[model samples]
Target: MPWSAMRRVIDVSGDGGNNSGPPVEQARGRSVAERIVINGLAIAKDHPPFAYAGPVPLEDYYREAVIGGPGAFVVPAEDFNQFASAVRRKMIREMAGLPSRPRMALAD
Candidate 1:
């Protein structure tokens, strides 16, 4: 099927890096150019042996790894306790077509 007439999104969530799928950069490029928003949710802490697998700074990782498109958003859950609420808020914002606030960076 042609992509222009369809909406395609690649939602990527993992405890670790892209060790088992297609390269993320390529995926981001295509999705963004095609106007498909790639929203991300990263769990900062998981249970048991899998706990350490998640990124230390999940929001940072999402910014660097998963989100794409004009208004892409990457919302992080500090731990499993906040996962559901975070995911709900992210989805609601995305679905409602809300715009993100400007981001600031510190100068050295």
Candidate 2:
């Protein structure tokens, strides 16, 4: 079958916010319109000091700007050491087509 016929997903794993290219939200909107699910793995390092301490938390940035589509959600890694576990869980959730419960969102 062609790619469009399969379960489509875009897994965006990063340590910082969207810094280049078209705005992430725009890309996400397009992908979501195509019936693709977007999930995020936010890597927040505690050691070596986390940079880009902007107004928004890293996970919140991913939630607000990077991830979209049905059942989209973020898996946060407190540090590099936790990346493996976080990725594993994120993959399982994706492969299982599970929707995140009590989805997190920025306050209105």
lDDT per residue for candidate 2 within 1-108, as digits (tens), equals: 455445678899988877788888899989999899899999986555666475798999998898998889999998888999999999888878854468688899
Clashes of each: 0, 0
Candidate 2: clashing pairs of residues = none
Q: Work out the TM-score per prediction.
A: 0.67, 0.79
**Worst 10-residue stretch by lDDT in candidate 2?**
1-10
**Winning model by lDDT:** 2
Worst 10 residues of 1 by lDDT: 1-10
- Give the per-residue lDDT digits (tens) of candidate 1, residues 1-108: 554534455666654556667988788888788788798887776566666454446677678878987667777777878878987988787667754568999899
lDDT on C-alpha atoms for all candidate structures: 0.73, 0.85
Model 2 stretches with alpha carbons more than 4 Å out: 1-4, 48-50, 98-108
What is residue 74's positional error in candidate 2, in angstroms?
0.6
